[model samples]
Target: WTIAQVKAVAQAYGESAAMLLDGLDSGEPVGALAAKMQEAVFYVGDAEYRCLADIGERAHDVSGLEFVALREGSRWKVYPVESAPGGDYFVVEQILIRPRDAPESSPVIAIVDDDPLLTAEMCSYFHSHGYIARPYNTEATFRAALGENVFDGFIVDWLLETGTAEAIIQSIRQSRHGDAPILLLTGKLVTGEANEDEVARVIQQYDVKPFEKPAR
Candidate 1:
């Protein structure tokens, strides 16, 4: 393909085919650019002929810029074929890539509290705000959940039916998701204060509140 052709199509797609070529010129890995071309290009050949065709097509841009490879002595060689019609290809000279919106990713929120009613309340709140909510009633269940999924944020009770919230928060901080936001809810002022000092130190944020059973 011609340099002008590559630049034209890239411009039509709002991408910088020329800039990509420039990046490749700088000796950078073309993997990312190649991947993007896989999405934009309408057709892609099978594995055997894919790379050669793409490179061959791109090697020729303007009429005179011939693809060259040295064999022996002082002579250079050029392939007989011209620009391949398909597979991932880019035009690298100098162009601009227009900014585009990124794909949407939903945030997840995890709730760790012994009270079923409280779990429901907190889950409902997060869900209403467009977050995917997961609830756990015990330390074991919360730990198990972490082994399977990652959360954007977490809400742990000040006191569990079987263990202290501090211990659970500490364990969470040590997990792969240790840096995730954790909001601790508690009815006792002292526990809240203590958590706010040490355990809550690692928490992104926390809330203290009195618990009331939900009405049927």
Candidate 2:
């Protein structure tokens, strides 16, 4: 097979592998990864082969990526291969993995905010979409909860009742739960004294996704 054929084969395999992921929406990025996996081609003999095991072998910048072997009824399929370790993969975590050997559990998100109404809204939204949301009303409570539980993601209010968002973030990064994704919610102009420069700095420093308040 020519390079195009080899790549096409890889693409087909990769997308199928990605689709095996559980709990993720698996957006339009479905085919791109398998195409990328093909990019790591290694030639062997006349028939050609793509090493499915080596798709994301050297990733360091990658986050949130996981591979799982799924068995539904009589079917069995694995992503990035069961042979690969979590340490071998890097970059952005593109897969939702729930290994067949491991017991399945719903993903959880930690929502930190001072407003009861906002926290309730956020929790309700996530719960409706299959995730379990844990809402904290203050920085102290958030930090305390972090010590006792693990979360898949975080949504923090930039302005809290008892602490500043910057301080809360800094403390979070210093904790064991820092590796989780952190998203910020603040008005476009923000409250307190945080100017655009300060807000931008916080976003960059912590690698957070910021959601400015919607216009009324």
Candidate 3:
């Protein structure tokens, strides 16, 4: 495919992702959106080459399709023809997206608070905001979840049974999840029991906003 043709198709598929993001933001059903997105990608360059799936699997010269295959380890891997080695490939780009545990679900949020009442309230708020909230009473449970889960955000209380909020936030930021949004919640900030200046320093260092309790 020509550079111009490739750019057009890329733009179209890029818009597809944006549309899916919009659906998520609007609280639309993720199951439906994922089902639609999983449909066969058919935007090939013009009518020049017919885009086909499963061209008899191990065929060496699979034509009428817009893909090229490579043998990796013990398996044959396939990629779009436009992105294959040295063909008409103009460029290949990786689009960063929210990692999904299930294709049909909203993003996940993690809430770390020792108080069961506060944790439940925070989880309920996030659920109403279109995100699935996972709440933990201890850092150990939250840390265990990190092994198998990726979260879109974290709501952390300043004091924890296992550690201070600053230490917890620092640990999470350094972990494999990268930089997910961390919302710092503190009753001390409202009551002037904790040093606001020092707490603000931690926020400045971590680039996460300090949020006082939201109105119910």
Better of 1 and 3 by TM-score: 3
Number of backbone-clashing residue pairs for each candidate, in the order shown = 4, 9, 0
For candidate 1, the 10 contiguous residues with the lowest summed lDDT are 47-56
What is the per-residue lDDT of model 1 for residues 1-216, given as tens digits with 9 covering 90 to 100?
Answer: 688898898898899886656654655455644543321111113321112112223433444543222222322222322534333233323222223223235688888888888788878766544567888988888888887887877877766777567667767777887777776666654534334454444343333322322312
Writing each residue's lDDT as its tens digit, candidate 2 over 117-171 gives 8888889767644578988997878878988887778888776766458988887
**Model 2 C-alpha lDDT versus the unseen true structure:** 0.62
Clashing pairs in 3: none
Better by lDDT, candidate 2 or 1: 2
lDDT ranking of the models:
3, 2, 1
Residue-level lDDT of model 3, residues 1-216, one tens digit each, is: 475665676687775434444544556465554443311223234422112222234434435445544444433334666544442221112111233345336788888889999889878766644578998999888889977888878888876766467878888888876588888887776687667887888889987777776634
**Candidate models: Cα lDDT each:** 0.54, 0.62, 0.63
Tell me the alpha-carbon RMSD of every candidate. 19.0, 17.5, 17.9
Best candidate per lDDT, number? 3
- Model 1 root mean square deviation, Cα atoms: 19.0
Compared with the true structure, the alpha-carbon lDDT of candidate 1 equals 0.54
Candidate 1 stretches with Cα past 4 Å from truth are: 1-104, 190-216
